[model samples]
Target: MNNNNFLKPLLFVGPHIILFIVFILIPSVYGIYASFTNWNLIGDPVWVGLDNYKTILTDTDSTFYSQFFNGLKNTLLFVVFSVPLLIIIPLLIAVALEHKDLKFTSLFQTLLYIPGLISISAAALVWSLIFNKQLGVANNLFGSEAVWQTTQPYAWIIILIITIWAGIGGNMIIYRAGINGVSKDLYESAEIDGAGPVRKFFSITLPSIRFPLIYTMVMTTAGAFNVFAQPLMMTDGGPRQSTTVLMMYIRDLAFSHGESIAGLASAMAVLLGLVILVISAFQYYVMNRNAA
Candidate 1:
């Protein structure tokens, strides 16, 4: 390759590089620096060094601890319920579509993917109406009067339903791509060996798509941690703050509260980042160990 080939690629990518540096890297570094100080919007940051962290962990009256714990709990619960369904349901649909005998596979794939393309805010708004006690079709169909958000477990159920509805389609497409990439020769070989569809899936199809499965799992975990828009739009952190997530809490701290502890919000963001990093690392280790 000539020297100009390298220069041309750099020219194409240079704008993105500059934008990333300006928008992401600079802000991230500044946020980290701000985390160790006491700064609101107007005043000069006073170096408080660990005081914000101390307040988050120890201040009972502040409700910071409660919010953090509640958010953590809800996020974990959402992950636990949604992740498996996200994987399994999509995988099953992909497998069904992979069959040559299936009719209108292209049409089915398009219909399934339509939901993923819809704006999350729009989807959440529609579901919010669906879960509304007085006007919702769900209440009307069931002849029930329970307030979905005010009720304990039902509130969570509503959140889960909306989450699954919006999320499953993207994963399904990924899985379908993975399934399509598997060579027909492998299936023929399995057939010659008297292996059934179930056997072929477990032994051949699943192993062929291990990388996609791992990628999806990691993305899902990170997405769960950063879940803000759905709960924020659908529940507003809730009738009892049942749907409040960590990101929403951080936003509330940084902007909504007049005290506006930019430092505390930064700390929370950093801590959440650390949690995601640790979980991802652990997952990678376990996967590699199992492969080995």
Candidate 2:
């Protein structure tokens, strides 16, 4: 009977266990192993220990070295630029819509939420046209001469515009859900204590949503690190490759023209994964400690 009980639980979870091993577990292990070797797709992998890492980290004159640093720098730039806006805008909007006097909130929520559901490629295409120098609404309305895609600051702005538009909806929904869970009694009591809206928000609303804030902060930071499509589709990583992120470099190394540099690419990928793990751990530790 004890064995039967254990077997039942295993049976329920067996499919998921098998999938994790086959798809995620095995591939991750292989990719790590591959990072220590010199491999082209058709040739057998030759073990090179830390050579790939050495080249990427220390060989400053090499193309791989330049690409690695440049890619990482751009990825960090995107994360720094996008993550704060992604968190703050949604939070502000969610709080505003939750006000007692606000009406048709569901209608407003649906409108905000719809953009997150749109495909990135399709959204990027629309945005590209909207920023077009010759016929775009933005240019005509503002009487600007600069081509948004090719111009400095303007190029980055357009990318941020689309990213914020598509991303704000999801975080706003999360904030709304968290906001709804806070006790109404707390607000009423604070109101009786002569607390104004701002004081009540700081004392009640923000503290109540601590977990959701931490969760969204971590997830959004991770997502920002993996930003590829927005820059790829909007700027094609141009304006002199200023927007070429780490993923773009990884993709190009592994699958672009000529022989694939699978091993070196794997090394860069592993390094990126480590950077993310460390940053995420630090964020969680700091935020979770503060919450406690």
Candidate 3:
């Protein structure tokens, strides 16, 4: 019976195992292998051993490496600006909405979450129109002739604005869900102790959602690293490549500029993956240690 019980679980899990092996595991191993070869998608893959990696890491004049570094720098900048809005602003909104005396709570929740439902490509295109140099609504509204996408600081600023606008809603919903999961009795007890909203939030609300906070931080970090579509569509990594993000760099290396360096791109991918993994692991370790 015990053996049959185990077999039953395996039977249910067998399809998932097969799918994972066929899709994720196989592709990952193949990608690593392909990274070491000089495959241009048209000719046979020449086994170059570590040459591709060496070129990517050491070739200072190579556009691939230069673009990769530029993208990495921009991605770091995006994370620095985006993380606080993703975490703190949403938390504040969720806490405010959780108030029993708050008016139109459901309406406010729905309004906040609506932006998250918009398609990223469509949103990027729309923002591009708004940030257009000559005909943009923003230029008209501000009575300034500043070309948002053509100006260095304004290009990055536009990217940041769109990112925050599209992202905050989904994060707010997650935070609201976390806040909702907190036991009402805790709030009631706090109220009985004459704790005001600020005191209750600091002592009870924030502490209870520690798991969600960690989750939000990790996800926002990863998302910030992977920001590609907005910059790709809106800025084309322009304004002197100020908006060039890491994933876009990888994409350009792999397919764009009529010079497909698949192997070098794959090397970049592996390095990026390693960087993300290390950072995420460090974050987890720090958060866990603090909790302990």
Candidate 4:
């Protein structure tokens, strides 16, 4: 191998490696270290060992424990409620657009893809107003006076709506790309054998895009676990904190009024990361096994 060839590859990757270490590796190490201490982000961080984790995981009488679990439960609820719709809706839209006879396919795809480009805060602001109790379009259109944000099911509904609206585009595009990559010969063979649309999709499109399916599933699940802006901006973790996802709890702990609980907050974030990691690994393993 030529010295020049090796140096060229390193030169191209040097910036990315530096960025990852500076922005990701160092911060992750510090965050993990901070989780072991009782830091308030001001005074010296005192070494508290596993005290923060103990309180969060086992101290039922402690407020931190309750908040952690509640937030986690809500976060899981959001994942369960939104991930399927996120995956399925986009896949269906992609498949629909792939049909040769679909009119103005580009236009429809463009319309769907645009939402994912909007900032979460901006999208939440629009959704919040739409679902507002008074002077909101939804209430006027439905002729109902229900407060969407501060209500039980309605609170969750609005958050999920915005999430789906913003999320559908990206996964749909991915699915469309995957679907298009499926060999035309396979579909042709299936059609000659009298395989209908559903059969073709299942036996051909899905299997051909197995890796993409796994990738989207893991990515979508991970993103769902980190949900913050949707519930925060839309419901403000309201309706009796029903919408208070785990990220909200973590954010509140580290930055809310009074002295910050950076230590505990860091621990919670670490725990959330562990959950996502484990779940994503399991998803990959299961999908890879099935593909085999």
Q: Write the per-residue lDDT of candidate 3 for residues 212-274, one digit (tens) a residue.
A: 888888888877778888788778888888888888878876788697878778878888888
Report the C-alpha lDDT of model 4 over 1-292, residue by residue, as the tens digit. 8799889989999989999999999989989988999999998889899999999999999999999999999999999999999999999999999997779999999999999999999998888888887878999999877888888899999999999999999899899999988889998998999999999989898899998899999999999999999998998899888899999989888999989999999999999999999999999999999888
lDDT of 4: 0.93
lDDT of each: 0.84, 0.94, 0.83, 0.93
Pick by lDDT: 3 or 4, better one: 4
Clashing pairs for model 1 are none
Q: Pick the candidate with the highest lDDT.
A: 2
Q: Write the per-residue lDDT of candidate 2 for residues 53-169, one digit (tens) a residue.
A: 999999988999999999999999889999999999999999999998889999999999898999999999999999998989898998988899988888888999999999999
Off-target runs (Cα >4 Å) in candidate 3 are 1-8, 42-44, 191-194, 257-259
Alpha-carbon error at 112 in model 3, in Å? Answer: 1.6
Better of 1 and 2 by lDDT: 2
lDDT of model 3 at residue 97?
Answer: 90
Clashes of 1: 0
- In lDDT terms, how accurate is model 3? 0.83
Best by TM-score: 2
lDDT of 1 by residue, 89-157 (tens): 889999999987889999998888887888989998888888788899889998878788777777778
